[model samples]
Target: MPSGRRGRATWLGVLGIGLIVALLAVAWLQVRQAALLRQAVEVADDDAVLLVYQAETEYLRLRDEWSRSSDPRRVLDAPALQLRYDIWVSRVGLLHNERIGNALATDTGFAETLQRIDRFIRRADAVFAAPDGPGPTRVALQELEPELMSLGAEIHGLSLRAAHRVGEQIAARNATVQSHNLVGIGLTVSLSALTLAFALLALRQMRQLDRRRAALEDLAEHLRSARRDAEAASEAKSAFLANMSHEIRTPFHGLLGMLSLLRDTGLNQQQVGYLRTAAESADHLLAILNDILDMSQLESGRMVLSPAPVELRALLRDVEALMRPQAHAKALALHIGTDPALPERVLCDATRVKQVLFNLLSNAIKFSDHGAIVLDVQARDNEAMAELVFVVSDQGIGIDEATLGTLFRRFAQGDSSRSRRHGGTGLGLEISRNLARLMGGDITVTSKPGEGSSFSFRMPLRPVQAVPAPRTLPGDAPPPPRPLRVLIAEDHVVNRQYMAALLERLGHDAVFATNGREAVEAMRAAEGKPFDIVLMDLHMPEMDGIAATRAIRALPDAAAATVPIVALTADAFTETRDRCLVAGMNDFLTKPVSPPKLAASLRRFFGSTGGADFAPEPAAPEPAAAGGESPPLVDTAAVALALQAMPRERLAAMVHSFLDQGPQLVQRLRAAVRDAQPLELRVNAHAARGAALNLGLAALAATAETLHEGASHLPAHEIARHVQRFADLLPATRAAAIAAGLPLPAGAAV
Candidate 1:
């Protein structure tokens, strides 16, 4: 039952009991009032009878006195007798009004009694008014006595009936009160029992609630302790990882630095080759460590993705640019294709996406020797989901089913041999998969052992609706041209000669600097005819390419500081490229310096529309006359003719001036190479590359490039070979110039 209904029922029962008590009390009071009325009537009836008897006695006495004396005194006695009669009549009248008429009007006996009283009173009055003086007391007495006696009897009957009815009513009220008291006692006992039961139930509920609350508090305390423990564990793990990374990096940095310093110490061919391999291993180790650190940070949720609108075309171009060199080295064909439906721009984390692409492309290049790598991008609209997908597939040594299963598993490599041959920490695929998932996408692989492998990357790429296409800079937009002043900074004399020869043939006026520092110095020193572009070497002893670039950028003069600087290096790592950019270099051109890469670098700074149209650089000048003798090896006139072929008289003048300075430059290059001073070797090589390039001596410039690259690790004897080669070429080069109607300067060998 509902509590409210129960309470209402209890209140109604109490109200009913109250009403019953009130009614019973009223009944008892009524019975008592009836009893009093009946008693009063009986008393009145008795009083009337007594008064009648007294009047009768008095009347009889008065009558006797009247009969005994008829004198005047007798008349006075009669009047007094009449007064007593009047008193008796008044008493009778009171009896009738008080008892017979008012108290018992409804009762026949009581009415008869009232009538009898009235009759008796009438007789008394008549006697009192009689003139015979109390003549016959017997006459008045006789009439009143009968009437009064009859009234008394009637009054007695009426009083007995009223008293009986009142007594019966009182008995009924008393019985009712007793029954009511019994019922009230029962109700009180029942109420007490109910209150006790309710108290017990309430106490039980309170106890149960207390138990539950205690249990909850205990659970809360345990949970708080567990949470604190988990937090402490997590913090400890982060601290350990940070410490480990720092410790590893410190030693690794020293190792790389020592390796760098080792290059300056002269080493034989075998040692040089071993050192190169070791350096490569060190680099790979560093890469793996970095990748692991990156993965750990990413898993810890410490790294945040930076999304930006990126041009897919430009991104692909960069990817191709990065991977092309690797493919060339491996003798592999790389194919990149995209659907025209692909969006111009996509919303993505450019850095992460680029990283993924680089990893994929690098892996493909690593595994493939002669096969092709195909990068496919498609934009498809499906009814369920509209998105663009990118896939990169390669015709490399494929993975088996078992290997593919664990392809993206952490720290899992496809094969032990593969890991040994092609070193990797195996975190790349795992990280890539995690990154893809974070981007609301995924990565998958399909491969067949001994056939080929295709790795596919699918991501939900949002179309960038409002991104503008990148505009080509004014310098890069124009067609290839020449007759421009080009600066070549190298450290090997032969390589410098080779570059100068190539530049002359390309119809570009070339200036020579032995090293990056000298290149910057030369540019600063020039009063007029400032070099338009600087071709910088990566590894020069005194001031490396990066440092020189920084120095040039910080120069006070605008012309020297703002000149375009391109790096010529053998290190093609992404980190190296980043370093170049950080150093304010305009571009990166890796060695062994090829004609196409060289032309491209030059074209980057010099607009194509209108420049010199020069002849091809002369191949190598004929070797010096037989066995270690005094033969003029180079044809200087031929070199001059090649320069003049560009139809630029100014370029010819530059060539002539360069030849005049050649002997002195050669002497300095020999001394630097003999001393095994990388910095000086770099300076001399750079000068020769420039001068040789200006004179169209392709062979000499190429040799100088070799000396430049190998300077740090190449032994003193090896360095001497490049110096001797450059020295032998000077005579033939001067001869070639003079033969082309460009006279050699005074004291110049011919």
Candidate 2:
């Protein structure tokens, strides 16, 4: 062949190979899509059939209950049966909703199977609803009996066909994948050979055109320089984004804290309402910011789900409680009901579920104006598969059909007008839907022009069986019967009062220390016994929880050295929580402690309810008569030894520095407030946190933490509140410090 024809023929061969490869890929994609569709339909069918089974089981159960009932119970069984029957009807609708026939288009076997299941349901309903007068409904049930079996058999047959189809699709995909691999290998080898051939030809041409070499060299050099410049610019852009995020977060925290405090301030009714609305708006803003952070993390493939068994009813109730306030404000009737058939608990991500439910309910409230909102949970069935469905419906501004279609899409609001009115980042629904699907479920919406709209989120959840409680710790070995005397070291009056009440309720006597140093002193003065446990607050004046715990655990006496120390803090972040555990604290409790949590902690420390054996020994005999004197519940020498474990000079220095600077810091904070400079107010507040934290000034550090978190967006008065708090802290902290006999720096008055 002539050289031109040979070259043209080679190009044609390459083109043909490319076309064949593309066609195969398209076919493979179609097969994969078809397989997914079939699987979905099968799942839907299975769920429908499962609901039917549950209905049948319930019908039989109710009938049996009715047979055993005398009067009132029989009446109850009738209503229960009716409820299950109605649910069964709804489950049939779910199957029809799948539109499997239409979706498969030409999958006749699957279509017929769905039709059979529908017919079987009608027959089963007739037998299920028959009056109790019948001697034997066997004949009536027999009609359903064959159809039920056949329906199942047909479904099974369809499933097999679907499976076979999926297998074929898989084979096709494998073949296509193999073809692609072959094409790629062929292309690589062919291209390499062609390049080598071209190189040989180019060498000959270069030999003939050596005069042009300098131009090519200069072009190559410029290209390399441009590539390097582009890379550097890209890195700079990333750094800028990171810096911006960090900067925004720091000030945003301040804004949030101030807003929280403002919410606590006294205001007129209307002003209070407005403040609440503003706070909620701010909270929503913070959530959006957090979502962006989460999205970034998720995109980087760093998101991991820590799934656990969750009590679904409890989770749902919590969501309803949170939204009830919003509904009440709107004067809208909000009703929440659950399916009688839904398992009490399920294995899923509880937090994610709550987040999804919260988003849906919030939307329902936001869009509604007059009519009641109803959230109904039901056990939906399609054939044999069971799934839980959550429906949130409202009589508010309904979404148009056009917009409803894209309701769950990312960053999509119903329309521009709604987006403006609602003021959302439009990520709530998308995140909800993603989270739903992540948990083997999905979210969908249905709305009409003027009526109400309903959003239903459904997920496939595994049925949970209650596990029997453990009898005892292994081998029937009982825990030690030592009496537990707990020392509670907390500074906040309200918190201290609440903890004291909780401890007293648990049948344990508690000794209170207002600050860290007093707690240490109390332990040191005890003559006879050892305090079994020390519940230390992370932020306290004079000496804080972490240090106090370290001090106590380092004591020379074996009982004192080994006494369990639990940390109490307001921060629930992983880093903070982990630090307490690593610092030798046995456990941690977040602030606003509930009674149950408090009791649980006590139970963990002391076995069974007879009585705690640990006690703190009372100091010196001069204060009490011999008969009234209790045995020393703590060892003073051991307490002193623990305090000496850490470098005494360093601890003393930190204490002196905090006291020396306290007055000046307070003065600067007051000046900042007088100037009405929020930025300066927050700067002082941040400094206060570091200083107070070092000195174990719990109350001041918490106030500082709050101010630092809420500084950027808080109103002026909110900033003023923190500044006032800082001033108040100075006097109380000095008094507590002096009372504990800590040396104050010269001229620093207590």
The candidate scoring highest on lDDT is: 1
Query: TM-score per candidate, in order?
Result: 0.32, 0.29
Error of 1 at 539 (Å): 5.6
Query: Candidate 2 lDDT, tens digit per residue, 589-663?
Result: 765354444556666656453332333322323534655743232223322322332234433444556655666
Query: Candidate 2: where are CA atoms >4 Å away?
Result: 1-288, 297-302, 383-385, 469-750
Tens digits of lDDT, candidate 1, 705-746: 677778888754466666667766766666665566656455
- Highest TM-score: give the candidate number: 1
Model 1 bad stretches (over 4 Å)? 1-310, 313-404, 407-534, 539-541, 546-565, 569-599, 602-648, 669-686, 698-729, 741-750
